[model samples]
Target: MPEPIELHHQGVERSIGCYLLDTDDGPALFDCGPSTTIAALKVGLAAEGLRLVDIRHLLLSHIHLDHAGAAGALVREHPALQVHVSEIGAPHLVDPSRLERSARRLYGDSFDTLWGELTPVPEANVHVVGDVVVGLACFPTPGHATHHVSYLDDDGTLYAGDAAGVRIQPGRYVMPPTPPPDFDLEAWQRTIDEMDRRAPERLALIHFGVADDPQRHLADLRLELFDWAEFVQGGASEEEFIAYGRAELADAGEDVAVYDVAMPLWQSYRGLARWAETR
Candidate 1:
């Protein structure tokens, strides 16, 4: 299993991370943290004796800023890099104006500080992933986002972006990051079934670290996802939802602040609220 290179997002440990793994082609990154953490990313890569140019491919699970915000910046530094992303996500990478707008609307004043620059990855360098990508089984795993996908390595490590939910391990709690405009409970349930059917040995999570116990981790995620969705659908206000989530984390003996950094409880509430309204 590959270890996550902690980006130390906002100087918080294990809040955001990316993975560097070897592929049939060359060194590849599972997900690159936002451009704000590019400096830390370089430091982490240097510790592994690799420069930015040494990476040949970048496998993106989604186009969310935290997961792939550095795609264009990284490619600008290393033009030879090939970026493999879901078909729906390819165009967004080549032209991120709309993505930037939506994110700005959500993040408001803190946008620039949180994500830095949203550069455009040249279309020539972007490849829509198929059933296979750099020797891994690529498959759709939406519901977190319509464009969400996951890659299964030969070693049975699933590069599960947010589809696997957020679990800042060594912590026992799992929380779903159901961000707005695309948080479908039904779709996410099917995604969970698909993942369970494949039965990966481990999950490479971008929010924090790898989980050796996929079964237990996924079960917890499913439970929390449904619980949160139902709570929101039951008309829980933002404050009530936050309090509910904090209480759950506390009961589980997990660090509420760390989990919030990994996946904000408020954002999750908003996403669920939107989902409820739509339903």
Candidate 2:
């Protein structure tokens, strides 16, 4: 297969990216980015002489909006598209009422604007990752979210959704996206070790592009995950947390818009703080 194509979302330069893979069967999409960027995704695909209909497989790393919000839209457009996600997240996609309400509570008035229309994916089309996909293997890589999973192919390429953390650019510092409700530090550390054991040749991140150095990347990410959590544990105020996170992202060379839209600084800090408190 050719090099994976990166479909950059319009709002955030490198914050959210959906990758398209050319498989022996047909075109497969790794993550759908968000429902707001559905039009841009179509444009991106068209640039490569393709369209939404050409995508036969939809492998989601998780069911987070940034990763799988466009899934319902895509499946609705192409009824034949088979969506492969973690078993835990499959039901949420099928009946998104609770999910939608929870998201609205989090995002408030910005929910519709940021995420757009989030329709329910038919239960018939949704299948657990390992249960359906022929050759691809889905490993339960939680920590980022309870419903998170990473896809591993025969060539040692791992489509490590958020379980691998977010790397906006190569050579830039890796940032931990410890968002609320399910950011377990222990689980995340274990997941990191598991990823290292797998020794993937390349890690395709949903946040941005690919990272070739698995060893160094995982090590840096692991250390930062702990370091960030420690920082949050120091009893910093919400403002302090946001300021610190903003500076770190800026120092890493990410744009202001990318930081604002993708970082979710306060929410991430809250997640880490909650994890630390509960632990």
**Worst lDDT 10-window in candidate 1:** 166-175
Q: Model 2 Cα displacement at 97 (Å)?
A: 0.9
lDDT tens digits, residue span 149-234, model 2: 88777787888988988877654677788988899988999999888887888888877678888788899889998888888888
Any residue pairs clashing in model 1, and if so which?
none
lDDT tens readout by residue for model 1, 11-84: 89989999999999999999999999999999999999999999999999999999999999999989999999
Model number with the top TM-score: 1
Q: What is the lDDT of residue 256 in candidate 2?
A: 52
Please state every model's RMSD to the true fold in angstroms.
Answer: 0.8, 2.0
TM-score per prediction, in order, is 0.99, 0.93
Candidate 2, position 94, lDDT = 98
Model 1 stretches astray by more than 4 angstroms: none
For model 2, the local distance difference test gives 0.81
